[model samples]
Target: MPNAMTKTTSLAQRLLRYGLYAILLVMAFVYLMPLWVMLLTSLKDVEEIRTGTLLSLPGSLNFDAWGKAWGSACTGGTCEGISPYLMNSFMIVIPAVVISTLLGALNGYVIAMWRFRGSELFFGLLLIGCFIPFQVVLLPMARTLSFFGLANTTTGLVMVHVVYGVAFTTLFFRNFYIALPKELISAARLDGAGFFRIFWRIVLPLSTPIIVVTVIWQFTQIWNDFLFGVVFSGFDTQPVTVALNNLVNTSFGGKQYNVDMAAALIAAAPTLLVYVFAGKYFVRGLTAGAVKG
Candidate 1:
């Protein structure tokens, strides 16, 4: 009788597990449907895209649309394509991400390990930056950029992204550092290590997971930013996202959905690749940081 009951329980457990798996599969399909549609639309010619349903497969694989989008596409009078804009995005994102991450790490270390008078209050003010709406600062930032002679340049865009990105990165590192054992810091200090020394030797080595998470987050945020890019960047300095927008909205002949989709996909590829590669570390860092805090 006991053996029979155990067999029944095992069957129930398996059924429940399979049921959850089925639900997750459905959810995944639902989420991926849009991406599949975009890819299919990008591959199809204009005629097929206009006549066919969104979910329908392309009649034949064609690389022409992708090529046009990448190289020969026109945005208004400019026929330079997205290549230059893509380069501009990289130039902006790289510096912005590196500076923000470094500053965040330093700020987080100080806030988490070294307590000074009103430090918590200062940290609280910094945290407020994460919650404030970007719109509120847009005009002020533009004015500041003009004052600094950085208006309408890649450098200006990078500065804007770095300022906005630091808050989130700081939060990430602070929470992660807060969870670290205090004794490790104490021992380093006792051994005559200073703030920078301990950070360089001890904290950074153990920060791989959180650093990966921060980089991925910052990369995605800065790469995908359109508002700041549009406002701050000139034609030559424009990031890919702004360029994509211009390409899509350019009324050269008519709306070419295929070209627009291809451009978007190209623009989105880097952030998507970053997430796909570092997704494991991203999840691990979130979990560990939350648990430790």
Candidate 2:
């Protein structure tokens, strides 16, 4: 009787495990459906994409849409395609991420270690600045760019990113720095280390977690940014997001869903790849900076 009961309980546990596995498999399919559709649509010809059932395979597989999205698709009066926009976006985003992250690190170090008058209040104001909606400040920023003769240029877009991104980045760094050992800082100070010298040699090395978080956050923001690029970057400096938007908005007699999908995928590739690869590090950084002290 005891042996029979044990077998029954083991069998019941196995069934429960199987049920959970089934449910997870179904959930995975549900979430992946959109990406599956996009990939299939990209392979189909225009006519096939239009007439074929969404679940059905294309009549003929083709790479034309992919090529067109990357090199030949027309955008209104312009047809230079997604290539130039890709380069311009990288130019805008990379420098913005680099400069913002470095500045944030320096700000975090200064605020966490040094004694100054009303430093907390000043940082509190900066924190408030981050909460203001980007739309609220867009007009003022645009006007300022114009005043500086930087509007509608790559530099202008980067300037906007740096200005806004700093608040968030600084918060991350400041919080992370606060969690670090004050004795470490005090020792360095007693050794007559200047602020910049200590920051370069010691604090930065231990800030890997915050740095990864900052980079990932900034990359996603600047890469996928729409409003800033559209408002600040003219045709010559527009990133892929704006270019892709133009492609989406310029459909003619029939929509080129395949080409449009391909363009979106191309625009999204960098962020997607970064998150998939560096996601673990990003999460680790956030956990480490969670105010341990």
Candidate 3:
């Protein structure tokens, strides 16, 4: 009787586990449904999209829509496609990420290691930037950019992103740096290693995890930004996000669903790829300093 009861309990536990797995599988499918639709739609022509179900498989792999989205689809009034705007995004994102990351690292280093008067107050003030809404700064930023003759330029957009990104990057680095051993900085100082030397040698090498976190964070934010890109960039400097919006909205002939889907996918591809490749690092970095701050 005891053996039979134990077997029954074990079977119940196994069934429960299977039930949990089934729920997880269902939730995952629901979450991924949109991506599934987009991929299918992008691969299908307009005819298939109109006649077939959203989940229907494409009759054949089609590259025409991808090609059009990349090089020939009209966005706004331009027929040059998203390629230029995509390049513009790259131009904006790379500089913005690098400048913001470096500046954040330096600022964090100072705040975490170098004590000075009003340092805490200064950090508090800096933190304010992280919470400020994008809308709140638009007018002021536009005016500032105009004053500096940077309005409607890729350079201006880069500057805007760097300024906006710096606060978060600084926060990440500061939290991470504060968790690091103070003894390392102290020993380096006692050894007569200067600020730059210690930073270049000891601090920076130890900063890899945080650096990855900051880079991924900033890259995703800056790359996907639509409002800033649309507002600050001129026709020639519009980022891929803006171009994708225009591509979808522009009414020329019949609506091209496949091209729109392909363009959307293209715009999203970079951030997706970044996450796919470096997602583990992002999570690891976040946890590295979790215990302290």
Candidate 4:
């Protein structure tokens, strides 16, 4: 009787496990459907696109659309394609990520380890920036940029991203640092290490996990920012997202769905690559300090 009951329990657990797997599989399929469609559509010719349903596989692999999207398809008034705009996005993202991450680390180190009068209040005020909507700051930012002779420039865009991204980066670093052993900082000071010296020798070296998280977060956010790119960038300095929008809107003779799909993929490739490579690190970083404070 005991053996029969044990077999019955085992069967029930197996059924439950199978049910969960089925549900997850369905969810995964739903989420990946659009990407599958985009990839299929991008590889097909215009004729195939017009004739085939979204799920239909292309008869033959064609890369003409990808080439055109990269170098020749018209974006707005220029036929230069999204190549230059892609470079512009990289220019903005790299500097913004570096500056924001460094500033965040410094701010976090001070707030977390170097307690001072009113530091909590200062950190609170800084946290407000994280909650502020990008739309709310548009007018003020435009005016400030214009005043500083940076309006519609790539450098201005970089500065804007750096300022906005620092809050979140600071939050990540502060939380991570707060969970660290204070003895480390104290021991370093006892050893005659100054602020920057201690940070460089100890804290910063141990910051790899949080840094990966911050970099992935900032790179994804800055790289994928469309509204800020469009609003802050000049014609010549437009990012790939803006150029992709223009490419779709400015089609001359006919709407080329394949080219549009390919351009969209090109614009998204950077963030996708970042995630593909470092996504596990991102998850690990988020959980690194979870067990402590």
Scored by lDDT, the top model is 4
What are the RMSDs of all candidates, in order?
1.3, 2.2, 1.6, 1.2
Q: Write the per-residue lDDT of candidate 1 for residues 197-279, one digit (tens) a residue.
A: 99999998988888888998899889988899888888789899888988988977778888888888999999888878888
Q: Which lDDT tens digits does candidate 2 get at residues 48-164?
A: 876787878877779889999999887766887799999999999999999999998988888887759998997999889779898999989988999999989999899899999
Per-residue alpha-carbon lDDT of model 4 for 22-65, expressed as tens digits?
Answer: 99999999998998999999999999999999999999999999
Candidate 2, backbone clash total: 0
For residue 278, model 2's alpha carbon misses the true position, in angstroms, by 0.9
TM-score of 2: 0.92
In model 2, the runs with Cα more than 4 Å from the true position are 1-23, 290-293
Angstrom error of the Cα, residue 98, model 4: value is 0.7
Ranking by lDDT: 4, 3, 1, 2
lDDT of each: 0.90, 0.89, 0.92, 0.93
Ranking by TM-score: 4, 1, 3, 2
Among residues 3 or more apart in sequence or in different chains, the pairs in candidate 4 whose N, CA or C atoms overlap within 3 Å are none
- Mind giving the per-residue lDDT tens digits that candidate 3 earns over 184-253? 9999999999999988899889999999999999999999999998888998999999999999999788
TM-score of 4: 0.97
TM per prediction: 0.96, 0.92, 0.95, 0.97
